[model samples]
Structure formats: structure tokens, C-alpha cells
Target: MHFIHTNKSFLLISALIMAGLILQACGASPETTPQETPLAVQTELAGTEVSIVTHSFPASAISAQEARLSTIVMGTITMLDVNEGDRVSRGQVIARINDNQIRAQLMQIQAAKMQAAAGYELAAAAFRRITNLYEQESATRHELDEATAGYNMAKAQLEMLEASEQEVQEMLAYTVIRAPFEGVVSRKFMRAGDLAAPGQPVVTLSSPGLLKIRAHLPENLIRELTAGETIRYSVPAAGIEMDSVPLTRVNSSGDQMSRQFSAEAVLPDAHESGIRPGMFATLHLSISDEPAIFVPQSALVHRGQLTGLYAVTESGQAVLRWVRTGRAHEGRVEIVSGLRSGERYISVLDTPVRQGQRVSL
Candidate 1:
């Protein structure tokens, strides 16, 4: 029984070996081996392009015509007819100071003027009477001279008082503050019942549509600016971009303290857009133009403070190399060093690319 069991085991092993040999000889199944999978990546050639190097200097929207409303007289603000953001026309009253004192003075002057008029009338009548007496030889020469001096003094006194009265009236007019032009009330520095001084502003009136982009740039940048040159600008808050807008003014002479000149560009028409004064704006001024190699920003691998991108080799391998970058325009960045022209670099890395990973173009 043991010998029979051994023969049965040997027969089973022999049958399995013969089947494997027959399958190999007949080519029923081909040999299989493992292969390395290459990763798919997108690449672009690093070449020179006409890169218009633009600089973004901070800018603000400012009203071209702005006025600070106030009165020459120092007194308590009696009436404030408008608040901030109120629309007003030219010559419209915006605020009034305490004009009671001025008005009272005007009345007192008017009374004095009337008295001076009466005195002048009396002097004129007396002069005429004295002249008739002298002509008829009934008055002495000394008496006629005395009347002439007296009449002249009276006439001068009357004129003096009348001039004082007109001066007081002009002071009364200064108590009322009015808008200088058609504009909106932007700020209120003093409220009703507040003591207002000659220089202290009561309200600020600013023309809304008359806005310009004001930028304080360095001397180097101001040299490249020119009037009537179309450029690009954007209102950051409103997300509005206006291209082809001409630069209306460029001032090379800055204030003594600032040492930075100002340049202006016309703001977009307020009627067509929601751009307003005081909104933040960014002006892209093209300071220079040169041919340079650039790559997309997405390909940059930022590790701590260093920036790097994957460069594809001719041997179908991705090698991550550190590079020095320069000014960036839109989504592309300038490669200043570490990458040469005509070299292939990854522009868009949607996968987790490594330092020495194999990649397929």
C-alpha cells in the first residue's frame, strides 16, 4: 500500500511538469516582465518674448477740482444746510456763521451814514449861503474861507462813514458759506454751533466726475511718462480695468519735501461705470521693453524663500532646478539666471512633481 501511494504521488508531479513544458513549447502564453511607468507632464520652451516691462505704482483717485468751504469771519456756525455727500450747485449756501453780530454792526453803520448825509446837506446849504453873501459883498473874505474849510471837512466825514457802511456789508456777506461750483459735499469739518475760524474748513465740495488717477512716483519712473500716451489702469476696489486711456498730465517737478513727481490719467466716465473719487487705483506704466525668457507662474515650486521649477532633460527626465527670477507680467515670470534659452521647462505642474522623477512630454 505504501509503494502504491508513492507511485500515485510521482505520477501527479510528472503530469503537472509535462503540461508546463508543452504550454511553453506551443507558445500558448507569452513571458511577462515589469516595466517602469513614465509620468505625463506639460512643458514649454524657454525663449525670448517681447516683454513690455511694466511697473505698478500705487495710485489713488482724486478730484481735479476740490474746494474747502469756509468763511472769513470767526464765529459760531449758526446753520449747516447740507451734510456729507449732499449735491450742491454753484453759489448754493452750504453753511452760515453767526451773522447776528455782523448784521448788528451793519445797522449801526447805516444809522451813522444817515447822520453823515444830513450833516453834508447842512454843510452844502451853508456853503451856498456863504458864497451868495460873499458874491453880494455882504460877507468877509475870512468868513468865506472859514466856510470852505468847514464844508470840505463835513463832505470828507460823510464819505468816510459811507465807506465804513459798505465795508460792513461786505463782512456780512462773508458769514455765509457757499459752494464754489457744482459738486457733492465730501466732508464736513465743522457742524452747527461749532466755532468756525477764518482758515478752518466748514465743508468740502468736490466735483465727482472730475476725477483723475494721481500717482507719486520716483524720478526714474517719471522720466518715462508722457502726456497723451495711452496706458492701462484698474480700479482695485471696483475690479474695473480701463485700457487705452491717455495720460493727461505728467509733472516732473515734485514738491520740495516729497521729491517725487505726480502723473495723472483721466478716470473712466462715472456715468458709464461706478468708479468714484477716493477709490484705490493701479496704473501699469511701461517703463521699458526688452526681449527675455519667461515661464508661467504655476510652474514655480516655492520651498521656504527659494523658488524653483522642473526642467525637462533631453533624456526624458524631470530635474528640479533652482532659478533666479525677475519682473513678472500677468502669469509669466522672467528667468534671470539658472535657465537658458531654448531649454524645456515645466510651465504647468498639475501633479506632484519630484526632483528626479521620470516624465513624458
Candidate 2:
């Protein structure tokens, strides 16, 4: 017709210019000044007072005499002479054993004790010449009883080879191992050709000159423990701290399947506190302070296994709180429950926020 009515008026003016650019992009309005600016963060006002109320537990650092050492015979180690931390003392030999078959059976029992002291010195010179010829009557009472039975069988074969050369010199001093005290050789377990036997061990020692923490405590905190009181230990994995520590052993039996109670403590300068033995420690104890909550471990917030903190709410927003931590002192962290002290939280984040995220001061 007129070219199909002028192409249907150019398709109705390109569909009204795409609906007026979709209503001018739906009345435009999204620039939100950098997400409504607010994320400033870094707070902390979780108060609550009355401090002390301690009660820690989980201790360890023992060694009020460790030991181990072993080897009472059954040779072949041949001179190891102390090593693993070596300190040794009480007779300090430390290791030896291969005494060439106890020095060749102590040189064949000292050559049979020098042939039984030359046959007991020729049987005491023929029993003093047959008792001086039977007091001058010229011997023979059967030759003075056959020279007194050959001088009492050569003086009982030289006293049974001098008691078999003093039991082969005490089995050659059990091939020397020594050190039954002074300690510090934490552990060696045979090395110089290693063969050792009789009870195995070979070295472990310890004795940080009397240290001790040991803990277990729970028969309701062993009735507030005593033995000399003092308390407050800590080992934060060996950074060790002591402060009064004293409680020395409180065991009156209780562990019938861990009702607990096996205390210890005693750190009297733990031999200059190099600590030692097992290690872990904690202790503390005090008890009646109350009002807890604290916080600040950078306001926590771990999520995947929950341990939280972004809390800010009251409309400032942030909110992630899940809390429930305790006893981290100094850098703060006791919260013990879903947080409630003063409440603001969100300690110092510098960016990654989210849950209702708004944050500011």
C-alpha cells in the first residue's frame, strides 16, 4: 500500500523509544555515597568488675624426680658417656657395658686368684712343718693326721677362690652405667652400638631439681585446696609464670573414674625454673569475684565453628555476636556467654563487615 503504511510508522517509533528508556531507568537514584558511609569501627566498653574468682586447673610440668635410666646387665653398648642434655651426677658414669666380656671374665678370675694364692702358700708351709714335728716327738700320729688333712684342703681352696674373686668383682661392676640421681639427660635410649638389655631404658633422667604442677582437682575443686595454699601458676605453653604457687600435693584419693583430686603445685624456684617435664600447666584457683564478660580478643569472630563478635546493633548495625569464651586475661577474652556486659563490640575491623553492616565509631 503506501509501502505498507510507511513500515507501520517505523514500528511505532521504535516502540516509543523503548518505553522512554524504561522510564528513564526507573526514575534513577542509586549512588549511595560509598554504601552510605559509616564503617569506622574500633570500640570496647564491656565492663564488669570484682576480678579474681579464678579456678583454672589443667596442669602438668611434673618431674619431682623423673628417672628411667635402665640397664642392669646384658651388655654391648660400650661407652655412651652422657649426651641427651647431659647433667648427671651421683656416681656419673652414664653408660659403658661392653667390658670385654667383663674383662675376659676378669682375666679368668684373676688367673684363678693367682692359682689360689699359690696353693694357699704351699698349704701354709706344710701346716707349719707338721705342727713342729708333733711337738718334738717326731711327727707321725699318722704323720700328724696327714699334715692336718693337707692343711685343711689348702685353706679351703683359698677360701673358695676368695669367694670367686669377690663374685667376679661384682660381675665387673655390672659393666658401669651409674648416675642414679643428679639428672637432666632427658632421654637417650642406647646409641654406642646399641645392644643394652636388662630392663631396657638406657637414659631418661629429669629432676629439674623438684618442679611440680601435676593438677587434676575437681572433687568440687578439692574443697578449695590447701597444703600451703598460695596458688596462681600458668605455663601458657611454657612461657611459665609462678607468683606464689605453693600448694604441695593434695591427694586424699578421689579418681574413681575422675571425680578428680590429684593436685601438686610446688615450684620452689623450680630449680631455677627451666621448667621441664611434660609442660602444659595452668593452676590459678581463687574463686569468688563474679561480674565477668571482658572481650577484646580483637572482638573475636571466627564463624565456621562459631566464636563470635561483630556486635554493634542499637541501629549502628554490624551484628554478628555469638561469643562464649573465657579466661584469656591481659588481652581480654572472658565473655563466657553470648556477650552482655556493655554491648557495642566490633573492636577493630578495618573493612570486612557484613551482617546488617553499618558500623561507624
Candidate 3:
């Protein structure tokens, strides 16, 4: 019994020593304060103010006077003087058809006319001589009559030949094609040796003096547009924009398929702006004058499919707030939703931030 009690006491003392060692090791271990490093960041307050509410619609630049030049004669093209993009003057010869056959026919008619003229001259001389002989009773009446008939026939033939030559001359003139107005050739449909039929377009010409924007707007929006309303035109691809262009006209009829109405705006300073036809443009329409929230573009962060900004909470914690964005202007973007005016956002940060991360302004 004494041995068993001694063993129990030793076991109890060993257990106490192990517990004391465990406590000492735990006390000596490093402790974490659960603190996060503060991030240096720049913050901005979202703004809301009455601004122009404009809607952009696709459009294209067009000339006031555009034409397609066509051929008037059916023949093979012999000479093409001007190509696409060539500047031409009024009545300038731009193309010519093969006139060899017409020229040859004209020469033949002229030769025939000369022959007829000589025959008529001889016939007239013989008729006069025969009439004189008959009056003198030296020639028979039948002979004089026959000579008069021959003279009349020769004169008729000569007149017919002259008419034929005139017809040929007119045809020769038709072989040459000339520009009807002074403009730049926009396109060419035919080249040398190509067959050009009557009424077939050879080239397209556009006058650059007057320019306009052609756009199609929804039927509901057309009612708000007026003839002289001021608007804006922009070409995103060309990096150009013009303000205060007056609306020229609007079509009353709506397209059955597109449900859109066509509209036109004349550019008063097109020449000074160096605008050309066929360039794609955008037309901006002022729809309303309501206040909207706007934020700097640098504040936006895209994650997965969510577009949002890094906002600062009341406790100075960074929170990712998803937002709906509208059109962008300059360096600022319109915030449609999820972000309110007067709220602060981290516009710039030294290091990347996370949700619930502490940030210092």
C-alpha cells in the first residue's frame, strides 16, 4: 500500500510539471493584435448637378448635291481620263467611247454627199442646155423633160446624203462623256476597254461645298426635333465633333421595318471643318436637363462581369459597390445606379485594395 501511494504521488507531480511547461510555452509565444495595414489612397466625392442629358444616334455625313454620272452611248470605253477621287471641272471630258466606227461612217457619208453634189451639178448643167435647145426647136420635148427629172432626182439624193452626214455628226458627239458639274469623282464603275451601255453609271460625283448629317431616329424622338433646332454631330472614329449644327429637315413618314424616321442636319462650317461625305457620325440629342451622378473614371473597377467603384464606408473601410454606368464624357463617367451623390470613393490607391480593407484618406 505504501509503494502504490508513492507511485500515485509521483504520477501526480509529473502531470503538474507538464502542465506548468505547457503554460510557460504558451506565454512565451508571439501574439497577433489582429490589425491591418492602413492603405494610402486618394478619395473623391461623387457629384450631382443639372447637366445636359443627350442621346447619341448613329449617322453619316453626306453632301447636299451628289450625282452618279452615266453613259449616253452604247460602246466600248476607249479612254478614261479621270479616275476615282479625281477633281474635275464643269463640262470636263471624263471618258470617251470607241468612235472609230462612227468616224468611218461619217467619212463615208461625206464622200457620198460629195458624189451626189457633183452629179447634181452635172445634171443641172445638162438640163439647162437641153431646155435651151428645146426652146430653140433643136431638141425634142421628151429629151428636155427627161433632163429636168434627172436634175430633180440628183438634187433630192444630195439633200438626203447631207441629212445623213448631220445625223452622223450628232452621234460622234455622243461618244464623249463630260462632267456636268465641278466635283470630285467618288467612284468609278468602268475602266478602259469596258463596255458602257446607255444609261449605265460610269462614276459617282459628289459636291463638297455643302455638307449635312443624315441620321435615323426613333419615331417617338422625331416629334421633338424641329427644323432649326441646334444639335451636335460627332464622329467617334474620326475623333471629331461639331456643336450647334442646325437641323435641316425631318421626314414625316416612318420606316415600316425600322420604325425610325430619317432626319438631316446641315453643317454650316463643313468646309472649314474639312468634313467629307460617307464618314460615319453620331448625332447627339438633348433629351432632358436632370441632375445625375458622375464619378471619375479611375475610380471604376471591373470584377468578373460587375462594374463598380471602390467606395469608403463610414468606418474608413474599402467596399466594392457594383454600379450601372451610362455614357462617358471627358475623364468622367455617368453613374446610373449603385453610387449616390456625396459619397466618397477611392480615386487613387498606392496598393490594390480589398473589401473590408482599411484605407486612409
Candidate 4:
């Protein structure tokens, strides 16, 4: 009976083992099963509207007119009427030097001028009287000639004194510096009590009406620029951005050292927008017109040392494409090469993607 019991147990254990193997082969646990992600749907992508002909180059800002203010005469500065950033009109008094000595000299000149006038009058009368006497034969010829000569000498002395007085008056005027034009004062080099010397700058002013941007261009590119050609410019410091009016002047000649041509563009007053002289600016020169593929900046992806885009294929698969980029503007980047028009691209993907990986639009 015991042997019979052992045989039944063996049969039961064998049957249990076979049943377990069958179940394992027929079913899989959640952890062992491969997960399948939902396939992404393909959709039509909107075409990006980009400029057909665009060129970008390095640029710089320069003043259209710059003037250095200087004192015309040497004197101790007594008063300064304008400070830096002060607006001044043409012929407005900007500053004054201590002209007490000058004024005293002017007064002496004026007194001398009066004395000269009196002497001239006396000489004229004496000459007239001597001529009458000679005509009446009441005076000898030698006496009349001596009187005439004396009168002429007095007249010459008076003329010389008058000229000297006028010169002194002009010199006095130079003690008070005046604005040469209507402009804003950009600098103040001298203050009250400071000694001002001739040809030394005391202030700097620039015209408020005239403005331009100056930049140096490569010698090879100089031939492409011409007067009256419009370009784009930006001034970040002044928050100015506008399509610059045509270049009013172009120095076609290149610099001997840098071999760069000097160019200038005139800016309209309407576009000034608080831009001041010496503000930084940039210029975008137009070289040629050509068709190019472009993409929005949002679609770009950087991986290591490469820049590319995740392009969706017709089969709804993400294809990472390496691309060559060019000038960028207004959130759009130029695809110089490695891209074509009418191709759909993924601007924003939902999750991490790989090459040839299935994706949805």
C-alpha cells in the first residue's frame, strides 16, 4: 500500500510540473513583455514666410557731425552757462571768462578812440585854416606847408589809434564763448575758475538735426555699396530698429592699413527715437538676392557640436537632420543648406526622440 502511495505522488508531481511549463510558455508577466508606444500621427506643416534676399554683416555706429568746442581767448573761466546734456541754440552764450582786464583795456581803447577823434577834428580845422591863410596870402608858403604836414601826421596817428581800438573790442568779445550751432552739449571740459586757453576744448556739441551711421566695410564688399542704397540698422542702446534710409555717402576708397572702405548712412529724424550721438548701432548690408530655405528658431536643436532639426517624415517618423545655418532674424533662422522647401518639420516634439523613431505630429 505504501509503494502504491509513492507511485501516485510521483505522477501528481510530474503532472504539476508539466502544467507549470505549459502556463509559462503560453503567458508573459507585465515586466517581461515589450511595451509598445502609440504611433504619432502625421500632419501638414505650415510653411514659414521668410525673406528671400537677406544679408548680414558686421557694423559700427558713428556720428554724422562732431564738433569740439574751444575757447578762442586765454582767460580765467568765471561763469559757465551750460552743463553737459544742456540744449543750446546757435549764438547762445555758453560760458564766460574773467574779462576784467580785457574790459579795462577796452575802456582804455575807447578813451584813446575819443582822444583820436578830438585830435582828428582839431587837425582838420587847422589844415583848413592854413589853406585859407595861404590862399589869402596872409601866411608864408613854408608856414602853410609846415601846418599841412603837422595836420597829416596827426590824422595818421588818429587812424592808427582807431584801428587798435576796434581790435581790442573784438578781443573782448572772444572772452565770452558762444555756441556755434543749435545742439546738445555732450561734454564739459572746463569749470568755473578753470583756465581756458585758445584751441583747448571746453565743450563738445553735435547738431540735433543731422545724424548718420558710419561703418567700415570689407574692400571686396565696397564695390557692392552705392549711394542711395537702403539698408537695415539697429541701435540696442537706444532701442532703435528701422530700415535705414539710403546711404548718403560712400567712401569707395579703402583704408591703406585695414583695407576697408568707409561708408555712411543717413538716418531720418522720424526714426531717431531718442537715439543720441555716440550710441552703439549695427548695420545689415544688402549684398544680393537669392532664394534660401529657412526655419523658425524654435525648431532648432543642438546636440554636442552639431545643430539640426527634428524632421517628421511622411511615415510619421522623427528624423534628426544635420543642417547648415546662416543669418538669423526675428526668431527665424536661415538654413543655408541641408534643408528644402515644402518639407514638413517638427517644431516642438512631445518627448525625447531618436533618429528613425516613430512620432506623431
The true-versus-predicted C-alpha distance at residue 101 of model 4, in Å, is 2.2
lDDT of 2 by residue, 171-238 (tens): 77877878878878887877888888888888888877787878887887677676886778877655
- Which model is ahead, 1 or 4, in terms of TM-score? 1
Tell me each candidate's RMSD, in Å, in order: 9.3, 19.2, 12.3, 9.9
Q: How does residue 201 of candidate 3 score in lDDT?
A: 90
Ranking by lDDT: 3, 1, 2, 4
Candidate 3 structure quality by residue, lDDT tens digits, 47-137: 8856666788999988888888776668999888787778899999988999888899999999999999999999999999999999999
lDDT of 4: 0.77
For model 1 the local lDDT of residue 223 reads 68
Evaluated with lDDT, which candidate comes out highest? 3
Model 3 error, position 335 (Å): 16
What tens-digit string does per-residue lDDT give for candidate 4 at 1-361?
9999999999999999999999997896656777557456333354545364455555555446668877678999888878888989999988887888888888887888788788778878988898999999998899888888878888888888888878878888888888888888978898988999999988988776677887887787777778887778888777776566788888967889988787788777823576667777787885654455667777788888899987787877778889989877667788876667778887654456677877656
Q: Each model's C-alpha lDDT?
A: 0.86, 0.78, 0.87, 0.77
**Candidate 4 Cα outliers beyond 4 Å, as residue runs:** 1-66, 218-224, 252-261, 270-272, 288-361
TM-score of each: 0.66, 0.32, 0.50, 0.59
Residues 1-361, candidate 1: write the lDDT tens digits. Answer: 9999999999999999999999889986677897768899899999998877777878888888898887889899889979888899998988888888889888988888898888888888888999999999999999899888888988999899889888988888899888889999989897888999988888889999778888888877776778988878888576687555889999968878878898898766742577778888888887666788789999899999999999999988899889999988888988889799999988898999877778889
lDDT of 2 at 106: 72
Q: Report clashes for each candidate as comma-separated counts.
A: 0, 0, 0, 3
